[model samples]
Target: MADALTYGLGPDWEPGEDGLPFRRAARVVVLDDDDRLLLVRGHDAGEVTRSWWFTVGGGLDAGEDVRDGATREVFEETGLVVRPADLVGPVLTRSAVFDFARVTCRQDEEFFLARVPSGHDFSHDGWTDLERDVLDEMRWWDVDELAAAVAEGTVVYPETLPELVRALLDGWDGTTPHLDESSVLGPST
Candidate 1:
C-alpha cells in the first residue's frame, strides 16, 4: 500500500514560541471607482511561486516607516501615485512555513488603506528594488464578487482585508480623505 499523504507531512503544529503557526506580512488595499478592488499578480521573488491577487502593498523594509513603504510599493507596482489615508485595521494572517522560507526574515505585517484619485493615471514606468516581478495588469470588482473570489481562492487579499473593506464602505461618505504623516503607514510588526 502507498504511504499516507500525511506520513511525510511532518507535525501539524509549529515550533518555538516565536515561530508562529502562520507567516505574517503587510499589504495596502486600494479601491477604485466602479467599486472594484485593484489587485496585482506577480512573483514574490525570482521564482515561480504561487501567484496572489493582492492590494498594492508589500513587506516593510528594515526601519522603514509603514506609510512610506506602502506608497512606494504602490507606485512601484502600479505606477500610480497616492497618499496614505486611513488605517483600515490590522490583520494577522497565516502562511505555511515553506512559503516564508524564501523570505530573509519574518514578522507580522501591517496594512493601511489608501485612496486613489479617479483621474490619476497608473500607466507609467517606475521601479523599486524590492519589487520581485513587475505586474502591469490591474482589475476592479464589486465587493460581493471579491468576497466570492476570496472564498473560492480566485481572489486573494490579506486575511483581515475583507472585514476592513466592509468597515470602510459602511462609514465612508466618499469625502476626500485627510492625509497626514501620523495617519501614514509603517511597520507595526
Candidate 2:
C-alpha cells in the first residue's frame, strides 16, 4: 500500500506545552462566477501518489485579524485580490489535530467565502518556501467533480467541504458556525 499523505509542521518543528502546536488560520472557499470551487493539490515531501486537495489558506500572522488573514492567504496562495469586507465568513471554524511531516499540531481555522471571476490566475509566485514545497497544482472543480473525488477516497480537508460549498452556492444564510473535530478529517492514521 502507498503511504498516506500528511500536511503540517515538519520534523524539526515543535509544539507548545500540550505537545501539540496551536495555530490560528484563515481559509478561503473561493468560487468562480459559475460557482465552481477552486482547490489546490498538495503532496507531502517524497510522496507522489498520495496527493490531497484543499482550499487556499494558512496561519494568521500575529496581531492580524481573521478577515485580513483570509484576504492575505487567498492572495498569497492564488494571486487573487479581494477586499476584507467582501469576504463572507468566519462562516465556519474548524478545529483539527494531526501529524504531518513528523510533527503534530492542533489547528483552529476560520473559513471565509469569496467569489472571483472564472479563469482568474492562480499563480504560485506569492507562496512561501513551505507552501511551495507542499503545493503541487490548482484546479477549479464543479460540485459533481468534488463529490466524485470524495466518493473515490481522495482526501479533502474539513470532510464536510462539499456540503458546505453546496450550501453556500445554494444561498448561504450568512451565519458562522463552529465545526467540531467530529466533522473534520484529520491526518490518516
Q: Assess every candidate by TM-score.
A: 0.58, 0.86
lDDT of each: 0.50, 0.76
**Whole-structure CA lDDT of model 2:** 0.76
Residue 117, model 1: lDDT of 53
For model 1, state the Cα shift of residue 146 in Å: 1.4
Q: Highest lDDT among the candidates is held by which one? A: 2
Cα RMSD for candidates in order: 10.8, 5.1
Stretches of model 2 off by over 4 angstroms after superposition:
1-14, 46-49, 182-189
Candidate 2 weakest ten by summed lDDT: 1-10
lDDT of 1 by residue, 53-104 (tens): 6666655555667677777777776777765554444322323222322322
List model 2 lDDT by residue over 1-189, tens digit each: 111223345332235456555667889899999999998888755344566788888888778898998898898888899999989867788888765555455677889899899978667788877677778889999978999989999888877889899999966697988877732335421
Model 1: residues >4 Å from true position, as ranges? 1-26, 43-49, 84-105, 128-136, 172-189
